[model samples]
Target: MAGAETTRDPYAGKSPAAPLWTADFRFFFTARTTSLLGDAMLPVAITAAVLHAGYGASGVGYALAALVAPFAALIIFGGVLSDRFGARLLMVVSDAARLVFQLVLALLFLLGTPALWQILALLALVGAGSAVFQPGVASVTPRVARDVQKANATLRVSESVTLVLGPSLAGLLLAVSSPAAVVALDALTYGVSGVCLLLLRAVPMGPGPERDGAPSFRADLVEGWREFTARTWLWSVIVVFMLWQLAGAGPATTLGNSTLVTDYGSSTFGLVMSAFGAGSVLGGLVAIRLRPRYPLRAGALSMTVWALMPLGVALGLAAPLVAVCYGISGVGGAFWIVMFHTSVQTHVPQEVLGRVHAYDAAGSLVMKPVGQAAAGPLAGVAGTVPLLFVSSAMAVVTCVLLLALPAVRGLTRAER
Candidate 1:
């Protein structure tokens, strides 16, 4: 299954002969960009409010756990529902629901102090919406754009832009206004995205109908799982990705950020992050033009760049040196994301793409929180530097070894 190629796209001849940015694709792109912009701004405002209002550090942890819980729990269900109802329909509904939740949370912050549980519940609502929205978008992109690679690159560039702007905008607003304003602004973006999602007319190719008279949800889940596992290259890379995520996400992202701030100071940390953002933008722009033929293999190679982050920290590099390493990794990350998504969109059949994406999301994320939760305690015993070293080794080894198989090595882009 790894080297398998489809003879024809299901939606062949449907793509417009014009450039990538057709009317419907533009609307779809706008919807995703606006949503990401809001998501980018959200964490800073939430953290500021939680800390400033005396929710304390534990409250932030609790908030993240609350958000992750429902998202993980409902993500598969979201995929099934999206497949049944159509991507645009599900996305619009999800956005509308998130919009309401954000508005309510904003009102609570503006008017009175909501209990921690209440805030968590609202955040969970948002996460659920996110879970539902993600798979649909993955399924929808190939349908929306004539060139999936460029489309994915454009989205990644928008993400890079928002990464620079979102936090800055939130910080600026917090200086002059309240967290409620930030949350309200996020709600407004959701409204805009929802309206845009509702307007998409390009993707008439929805998912297949039910298997029998009334297929159980469990049956659908099984079918998706079978499809996912049918491709060894797909599952093998996922297992490798899961391992690296387990190692890097918590230890590298959660604990590593803390270490950077402690050792180099906030200013240095900001500089390093800014470099990463700039690199991501550059990567996205380059990827728009440089569409690699063997996207899956190239993408896997790019992910190995993440090893530099932990390696830089473990070696006690200077602030600028660490920044440069992370910046390179950021470029690699954008390239990897664009290539990976494009490969999935081009290779996977349209009917089951949503469900498969859900599994992909689940596999990639399932260990991240566990890693986050365990990193602090584990580091206390092993020390952060040693664990950082381990994380780097795991990334390099997993990727390099996976390349030995022909399945991973030989896979190419679908014929247009």
Candidate 2:
């Protein structure tokens, strides 16, 4: 049903307007970009707040984990609900919930020192909201845009811009005002995003007939699993990403941060990350222009670049050199994301798309915390440099194996 042509063109036979000019898409873009801005600011503000409140690094870690762990745990349920009730409704509910929690947290922050547990609890609620928000947002796009590729590219470009600017804006705000102010602003943005969702008039109710008599929760999950596992290419790439992410997360995040701070300084590390974000912008721009014949192949090949960041670090390269590598990886990562999402939207049936996406996200990220948890101990035992090298090599190997799979390399784009 995803790629299938219907008698009714959702765009209503009008000539394709620029993605930004399409009313529904325009609203969606504005909402997402505004929300991303807040998300980008949140980590910095929260970390600073925790430290200022006299919590140590471990407190920061637990606080961050509280946000991510529940997000991963509940995402599959979110997907099922999105497919069941409709993306629009789920998005509205999710944003509203987030808005309430963020406002509460901001108020608490303003009142004085809040306990660590209170902060973690609030963050966990926000994360639960995200679990619903993500699938709803992703699943709604195909319905809103006539040209999925261009739409995705446009969205990625907006996200890239947000990533490039949000943290810098947060830092400046923190320098002048307080973390409470930043969080209050974030709460305000969530309210804005909720209003935008209410304004969106054209998003489809997912998987029409199948959703008529909604199955039991367990049955819905089982059906989603069947859809996810039915496609060879889909599962293969997901598996590859799980392995690749598992290998890279620790090295890129924990080790990279530690090594850079020790060898260079926080400023240099920030510059390197900024370069990576810039590369993602470049990649999104390039994706808008290039329509690869074999999208899956292209995406898989692009992933080979991911190995370079760890390799550069393993070689004990200078910060600028390692930054260059990170930049390249960012480009590849952006390309892969655009292509991968497009492929899935095209190939997967619309009714089950949200569930499949949830599975994809869950599988890809389920191991990240494990990798983060293991990285420190592993580094202690095996040494950081060697662990980084091993991760780099594993990344390359994973890319090669994915490319070698007939299912991955041979899949073509679905007809529009």
Candidate 3:
């Protein structure tokens, strides 16, 4: 009944003053934020575990890749399942699965030595769960919130807060105890998130549209593809981001970490990261209040700031200067994400939203591993500073190219 009521009048009983005041939204937001806190701990915990196992740097890479590769491979399938079963159901299942996996991981770390293979296997399972969980959240958000823009902005704000605080919390835990302790806490968060999902009743599970007979997975996949390709603006942005992810992600992760940590030390690198996180939070707050007439165009334009990060590295700027650049870049990054998600939710049909989002995510992330793998070798050959400059220039070019597309420039926010 609540689901039907929401379908009929999405804005009913919604308070503009406090979007999260609604019981359903409050529950959903709390679950998501709590899950994010645990997620923030994962990278640190996994890396520490691998290194502790005496596997060294390559082991760390393999372990991280094991987690990411499965998500990248299975995200589209997860989207299809989400669309078929309903976002809430898929999310609940995902949360439960992750809870089990994390608990096992925690147990292994606490009770006995976790072989590197065992760690990789369990991490991959968590990644697969995330592949399902992400699209579910994306599809469900618009259904739960009356003010889509504010809801999205609020979601970004949550992520920004987690980004700022999660690592610090993880570090503090690491300092006092073992990575296993940190992981056990992550498992506890997953349990809490699962409980929150179990308590959520505002959304219901169901299949998408069916034709003359029962729904065929292949047919559904075809329909999703058609929906995705039908929009020039959507596909174009996806393409740009694929390249953007490739060029920007590798250099920032590999070169940025290596260079900054080498020259300025780990503390300075942490300060820069904190500045970036602060800027991201500020950007989300700004987006909450500022309504751009043409959200896509504004978002595209704002993304140019990303180039500043690589430029700072390329120029061999002082730590403070580099931190300033990262802060500006972080603002742009947050603005882009909120605007882009809002735009997609506004334009895409609800039935196929999960699949489309999955496709978009897959395309955007598929190249990340490639970038990560290549960054080291490329940096060795081309030099980190010069490669960073190229990456920076490429980011600018990608944004400009996207802005030049008529579809991208002309698209406006959907009318409520």
Candidate 4:
């Protein structure tokens, strides 16, 4: 009788178990994490390969740029495809494509027949494939989530776990043999992820063309844009994110890795990266217990942690100190990622989820190549340390901007 007196749960409309434990969620989650590990490993391995091949910082810059170049040109198309065809097929196909590309790279590297142009070409292909995989994976989460917050937390865990293992494993592979062998390991991971994805058997839920009359591509794109732009939280955060990417991610991905290669050996780079990954894992764990009253505020504040890395490096912090800086930053990044994705997953319409996610992807990543392309030549003129300083400062500014927006500062998770 007392049980009957209690009011029903507001979130009873959705499931109550954690999202990660669901069958579909577990399958896709594992597959994506495996693929992400492959992705993480490739950069470290490729960066090492280039340095070993006697390429300078400029060469490393171009290689990193190549990985992001296609995003500027083709990511919108990939997003549209995910919206049209659904995410599952796109993921399977992308993973299969990655497996093939990495396998070829591995063979070429192992045979000692590597060429800079060949590596760049392969990286471009993988980048193009990522254009499909990233949005596809993100859009699928709502279908399997118990709720938006749970979905976001689950995705964070997946990301953290992969980051934890990928770099360290890449370091091990690079140390034991060559970057080529590491590429081979990456290729195998792709294959495994693809197979696991094939075993996943859930039908996706989203809007598509009407049976009576199909909308034209242009109209569909317009609808997607409307959905994406209509949400202040969605576009505002991403606009800030785009600026942050241009100011920080490009430099960090390219120069940061290079700095480790030049200042520290491959083993040390691996350890620093492993520390970063470990920190992300810890952040994800913390996120599980944290139902922040202000999700967006928490997310914004967490991002400020990134500034520490460049400051540490600029202060000539070395070895373990550098590692610690990255670790702290990684934890912050993980928290922000969880909050941001949860915001999108929960707030956006399920029907237009793919299209909106596509728009988000395009918005968040559009400037990344610009940053990547500039890092090489800029570092040449300004010096790496100065460039790192400028980028870190910009990130801090972006984080501060988050405090001004009431929408973000006072956001909260839906209650059960």
Candidate 5:
């Protein structure tokens, strides 16, 4: 699966460009890109809608939490369903449901500031669709694309581009039109994604558990858990990332705004974020052409670069220096993601890939909210610079420890 596709692996020995020309890959990529754009814009639209309705920061928090809660809770089940029904089918169904929910949410805005509860409910439904769709997206690559790394690079590029453009575009639309109009545009993008998903030809990555005496849901779940736990290299990295999110990323995200505004005479937050996007674009492009022998080793090393961002801020570096750190970190982040995802797809058995991925995704996210929520209180007690320093140290320590595992450091592309 890694060196070259074998006969048993569905599509075999296809060149990197092979996926680009294939109808299936093209359709799937288009579906994902459009959906990503909608998601990128969704936060801005939701914020504008809530604020225009005379709500405060607390309301925005509720809306964001409503969207995040369901996805975090249900994503593991999403993996189960992906393995059961197949990736293509699950993606299509997820898209369709999300489309309906987004459309309804958009319409509600047209009714003169719809109730906060109504908006939150619709956003929750959309989040559930996302929970289901994510597993399918990860598992579907080997089925349609010839080169998994290249495919992942393409997706990363799309995500980075949308991150840079979506908010700016949303702001422009708000200036020229209503908040409901911006939301309607978000719904339209979902429609485009749904159509693309419907047009895709179904391809099963592995056999379903529907044969005689097949496993029940509980049994399947247990099997998936076993597969996840059995991999030392996998779980070890998951643990490291959990700590990285809890200590490094969480504080960086929550405290960054205050740092820029207070430390610098003005807010350069937007400028630094733009630098991250730019660096991510470069990283995705680099990923498309670079293939390493030891992906985990390289990916883990790349992640350590992220420690610089927190370190730079804690030291009260100039805006330009902090921006440079963010840019480099973004590049490292992209490399880590593509390498990690490609490694997972190539190493894990196709039958249980969805379930394993579910565990991986869920575990990585479980600590993030805790970290974000605790950051404020922790900063109040420990002081901002000290907390940021701790964040920076945690990242470097965790990543270094993760690489100490022989299984991780020695993982090669050709291994099963």
Candidate 6:
């Protein structure tokens, strides 16, 4: 049903954004933006809350770990769950649950119970919501776009826009009230997202087994694992990213946050992130217009720009260099994501798309906790500058390693 022509496939030539404005894309795009904006608020808010509670680097590290650990543990299961239930309904429920979780934090703050432990718990719960929502959206993309590339570009653009808007808005909001206000606003965004998700018509999930048999949890894990390992590029990229996440992207953002925002005393951490988002928006728009010759190789090559980010920070080129590095990384990351996603969607069978995507999420996220866990102590010993340089070098190494994998390097665009 995925590539097959049917009533679901529109015969008339139309731009991708057209459907997004009219139907499935509009609802999902709104939902995606709202959720992303809220998510962008989380790190800044969490860091502020921890500082307010008089917690040191260790406490902040733990808080960050709590936010990502669940994705490592539950993302594969999240995919399986989305497949078992309806993706649309699951998405709606996840958004609503997240709203409840954010509201809990707001209430806690209002009650003066803004302890580090409570913040940690709230972050974990919010992470769980992310675990569910991401796979749901990934699983449903085939149902919306006529072309895989269009679908990939559309989703990336929507995400990039949200990333840009979320943190910028969060920064401004943080100036006016306590971090709790950001959480409350996050809750409202989720509520609005839930409402929009509820209004969408039925989304058809492609063929799979009747699912008459209830598999054990371990069995489901094994099944997802088998599905994951079978793909050469998928698992290969996962392996590279394991090192990459552990060594690079994770610490660069989280630990670097402490250095840039806390130590440097810049009120522009959110703005820096927004610059990254802006670059992503540019990349997405470029992806929409420019078809790549070698998506896999190009993606990896684009990621080399990440090496410059740490160099900028290490040199203390905060305003100008940070902005430049972020814009480059954003563009590169956006293109990389589109290539990665389009490859998966085009190559993987739709029946197992959700589970496979879950597998990807689970594997990629597994290192997030490792990085988060190690960031604080490591930064404490290594100092932020050394870690920044080391992480940047590691990212370059990882990108090079990705190029060595035939599955990734040989990948090209699918026939439209």
Report lDDT (Cα) of residue 99, candidate 6.
89
Runs in model 6 deviating more than 4 A are 1-20, 45-64, 111-123, 174-181, 205-218, 254-271, 315-318, 372-387
Which portions of model 2 show Cα errors greater than 4 Å?
1-9, 12-20, 204-210
By lDDT, the candidates rank as: 2, 5, 3, 1, 6, 4
Candidate 4 pairs with clashing backbones = none
How would you encode candidate 5's per-residue C-alpha lDDT over 1-416 as one tens digit per residue?
11132225446555555645478888888888888888888999999989988888889999999999999999999998787767667877788788788888878888888888998999999999899989887777777776788888888988999998888888889999888889889888877887887776646433344322547888778888888888888898898889888988899877765787777644488788888898898889888888899988888788778887788888988889988998998898898898888888878876678888999999999999998889989999988888888888876787688688899888887422
- Model 3 vs truth, CA RMSD: 3.0
Global lDDT of each candidate: 0.81, 0.82, 0.81, 0.74, 0.82, 0.75
Model 2 global lDDT (CA atoms, 0 to 1): 0.82
Worst 10 residues of 2 by lDDT: 1-10
Question: How many clashes show up per model?
Answer: 0, 0, 0, 0, 0, 0
| Highest TM-score model number | 2
- How big is the positional error of residue 25 in model 1, measured in Å on the Cα after superposition? 1.3
What digit string (tens of lDDT, one per residue) describes model 6 on residues 1-416?
22332224441365543544457767767777777777767777777667666787888888877987786677777887776665777788888888898899887876775778788898799888878877877766665655667667877887888766666677788889887777688788889888877766536433234444547667656766787788788899988998898999778876777767875566566667677778998888877777777788888888888777776787788576787887888888888888888778767755457778998877787787678669888988988888889888986898889999888898776632
| lDDT tens digits by residue: candidate 3, 1-416 | 00122244456565545454477787788888999988887888878877877789999999888888889999988888888788888888888899889889888888878888898999999999999888887777777676777788888989888988888898888899988878888878877777787676556655433322436888777777888898999899999887877887677778887888898899999999998998898889878987787888888888889889888977989999999999998898889888888888878877678888999889888877788778889988989888888778877888798889999888888733
Which tens-of-lDDT digit does each residue in 1-416 have in candidate 4?
A: 00111222223465545444667767777787888788777778878877777776777777877887775567677766776666777877888898898788778777775788988898889889888777776666666556656666666777777776776688887888887777778878878877777776553322233211436777667877888888777788888888888878888777788888788887888788888877887777777778787888888889888887766666668789999998998889888888888777667654456678878878877887678778989999999999889777876888888878777777676532
- What candidate 3 gets wrong by more than 4 Å, as runs, is 1-9, 12-20, 208-214
Per-residue lDDT, model 1, residue 150, is: 87
Q: Cα deviation in Å at residue 411, candidate 5?
A: 1.0
- Model 5, residue pairs in steric clash: none
Residue pairs with backbone overlap in model 6:
none
Model 4: C-alpha RMSD to truth?
5.9
